[model samples]
Target: MIGRWIFIRGQAMGRRGWLALAALFIVALIVLMPLRMILGLTMPETITARSVEGSVWGGRIGDLNAGPLPLGTVDAGLEPLPLLIGRPQFAIARDGFSATIAPSRIIHANGSVQIPDGLGGLPVTSVGLGDFSAAMADGQCTEAQGTLSLTLAALGPLLPDAITVSGQARCEKGALVVPMRGPQGMERLTLKIGGDGRWQADLTLAGLPQETVEALKSSGFDTRPGGIGIGTSGTF
Candidate 1:
């Protein structure tokens, strides 16, 4: 009879222990669920996020800023599976950019972004980006098309070869120019700041779009056969 009683006691103790553990799990979720708010207070100074909404399990950030650069709005959510492997990852996205950032590196980050160097956020003068601000400000289409795959470097900046462009030219001037040849006759194109922090192109467009040629006139290029040269330096 005593042996049977002990067996029953053991069963009760096991059940009680499980119940306690379940309770703790619930509490932990509650405490950590509002991780977005916590992030605002603790995130690195270079990153500024506002109006954090969502639980620790997942969340959204409105108007996230990296120093003076505005990231607009971004959404980040925790992935459940990574937790099992002793590492946690958050899938983050903002506009044309998306990536999962972890302690070691940024995962599957793919997107394109322009960086500003001059007073008007234009590329530096040394890289020959004179036409960037004017073209962008007028909403003119450069017809540049391409994909952006980003991987975080051990240092803060993006690693070399992180930027890839496919268009009429790999680069021109101080910009990674992507002048897409399209059905509309390649009248437009796109340009982004290159990895060197200078906006210079490695290759100039062989076939210049009429609009691009006109737009770049001030920057010293024209629709002429070779599409004008970039080596010469002057104010247009």
Candidate 2:
């Protein structure tokens, strides 16, 4: 009778060991299965997603931690998996220009562009831009306030001898408008280039040079009566 009892106790202990092993196997499978699926994923169409609210856990594994994401978002329309593991590329249209950018929370983009021949045409081919910044606001595109330097090799053959115009411009009416200052000592100057190849400038010269005053007298730039002498040299 004592031997039988010992044998029964050993069998029970072995059964308990087998049950524990089976439980561990199940737990391992549960943990690894989802990770495998996530790693082997691909998306062919756009995915709409919302933030996960609470924590989740698995038995004998661990609690999963997920941070807050944007509330409601529509990803790129191509599907399988909406999230990309690596850098993404996309295009944005704003202010009459379309820009291609790297897809990220904060993106850094660099590319070469050509200014179009007309007011609204494709960009130039050889001209380039460096360190351009853009941001997404309310699901729309907005260019960040910063300096953009542009280089053009040949501007349509009409510009004066490959002229270089480098200055800061403000974004207005879907264009970059730069205000050029007049010549020295001139408060204001107006220049007009007509379609018939005629060029003219209206200038206000306050403290005029002696040579310029003499020339004005000869060329009829002097409009004042009684031989008035303007006391300054400037352009308007």
Per-prediction TM-score, please?
0.41, 0.25
| lDDT, candidate 1, 1-236, per-residue tens | 99999889767787778789899999887657786655544345556676788786677878765433455577887777886986666677877777665432235545544444321322222111111221111222222223322111111122122222234333344344544322333222243443233332222334655555565566554443454323212110
Candidate 1, residue 23: CA error in Å? 6.6
lDDT values, one for every candidate: 0.46, 0.32
Error of 1 at 120 (Å): 8.0
Residue 21 of model 2, lDDT score: 80
lDDT for 168 in candidate 2 is 33
How many steric overlaps does candidate 1 have?
Answer: 17
